[model samples]
Target: MSDKRRAFESPADLARPITQPVLRRPAATTMGAVLVVLRVLAGVWWLLALTFSWNDVLLDDLGLGDEPDFQALGNDVKEAISSGILNTVLIVGGIVLVIELLFALLVFRGVNWARVVVMVFATLSIIGSFVGWWLGGQEITVHTTLVTLALDILVLLALSSQGARAYARRPRERRARGSVA
Candidate 1:
């Protein structure tokens, strides 16, 4: 018989292994829990700012309070404040509240990027607070300043903990394993 080899192909050649990546939840750590609490506090801070302080600061302090030019507009000024200006302030405040809650949840989930983001924001807040106190000569009570600074420092420390770092890397580790043969 003439030596001829037909194309050797099996059904296995057509079938490919489908790799489904498994999702692993990192072990919960004390540092992570502390971060969660801090994040929740941050969210609450925003909630209070929006619900209580926004109107007072926007309408009374910064708005038409002592503006002589606004006095000429009179009734129109009242109408504008009642309609567009107040609505815009409320809208902006609501957006800030939403962002605060979302970031807090992300940080609580041990997202490394979220941790960095929150730390950067906290640092900025601290700087802004100090600058406002110094430059604006705003009379901020020692207790209020100290409490805010303490919360920010604690959040920074908790996010920098060894356990938090490991927890953040777990997703990357899973991805690495899934990519290998």
Candidate 2:
């Protein structure tokens, strides 16, 4: 047998770093940044909403105070339960924000699956917003609605741009090339 080893059997070949192709388009970079910013803004919005509305909306207005079993409980016990519930909500919300931020980062890295996920999330958010407006029976503020809609639209537009599409496609093309060879 020949002393020469096959390229695939070489340790160096296996250890070689696979470099990601750089995104050359400005639009792709901008879209990635915008998606991340949108996620950050969403996290901030949730924080503010929870901070401002937790006590009044959750405990008082929602009649957490008036639950028949809660009525018989001592004030200290009631306060503890309410505090526990609020803490749980905050923790869960924080987890969600973190997850959203991670997904945003993935999108920024030109992952096509991340782009699809973000698009799906944006579409769901838009649909949920409309459904809430119609079924919630609460007055919807124009400013909030407009801002939400604008962000969703902009995200969709940016991700759908030709430059962004090309950036996302690069990895798939690379994979195909490797597989063919």
Candidate 3:
């Protein structure tokens, strides 16, 4: 009882606190930088496709023809342009183009949110491209399609990295934890 009392009277020896996480800042920075670069490049590519092929893609092809019918294509394009779908497509597409350009700018500046937005849109765009290719049954070279798909996948993977996601989550993370990430 005396020994117990003496031991109890002595100051308690608490376990040492857990060590802080040794953050790999360099790795995070490198990954984040790569994601930004990929985002900018992919965004520019997408913007160009959206701009140059807007009519050919949405109007002349999908809106008018079954596949390679020039007459149907012309009629559809003419009707679309005259019947107001052209203006609607142009307006919406213009807005998207401007937003994408802004996103590209932000990504170049290492903005994580812009990277996330780019990734989302890039993924959707790639899917749409695939669907269009399939529907049109256009005889594209396998090598070209494969290369394009591979590049798109790489961009997506880079943007979806832990570091990129973490950076993007910075604001929300900070808000949730009541401190800056």
Query: Could you say which candidate leads in lDDT?
Result: 2
> What is the C-alpha local distance difference test score of candidate 2?
0.69
How would you encode candidate 2's per-residue C-alpha lDDT over 33-141 as one tens digit per residue? 5765776686678667866777776667679766888789898997788788878877887887777777777777777778778778878877888887789864456
Better of 1 and 2 by lDDT: 2
How far does residue 92 in candidate 1 sit from its true spot (Å)? 1.8
Error of 1 at 168 (Å): 1.5
TM-score of each: 0.61, 0.70, 0.43
TM-score (C-alpha, index-matched) for candidate 3: 0.43
Worst 10 residues of 2 by lDDT: 9-18
Model 1 lDDT per residue over 67-110, tens place? 77766776866666656765676577667656766766776666
TM-score between candidate 1 and the true structure: 0.61
lDDT for each candidate structure: 0.60, 0.69, 0.55
Lowest-scoring 10 consecutive residues by lDDT in candidate 3?
Answer: 9-18
Best by TM-score: 2
User: Please, what are the lDDT tens digits per residue for candidate 3 over residues 1-181?
Assistant: 3533232322222223223432333344345445445544554565556556665666465655444564545666666654476466557756765675576556545566677677777688678668868897754354234444555567577656555444443432136565655
Candidate 1 regions with alpha-carbon error over 4 angstroms? 1-60, 142-148, 171-181
Where is model 1 poorest over a 10-residue stretch in terms of lDDT? 13-22
Clashing residue pairs, backbone N/CA/C < 3 A, model 3: none
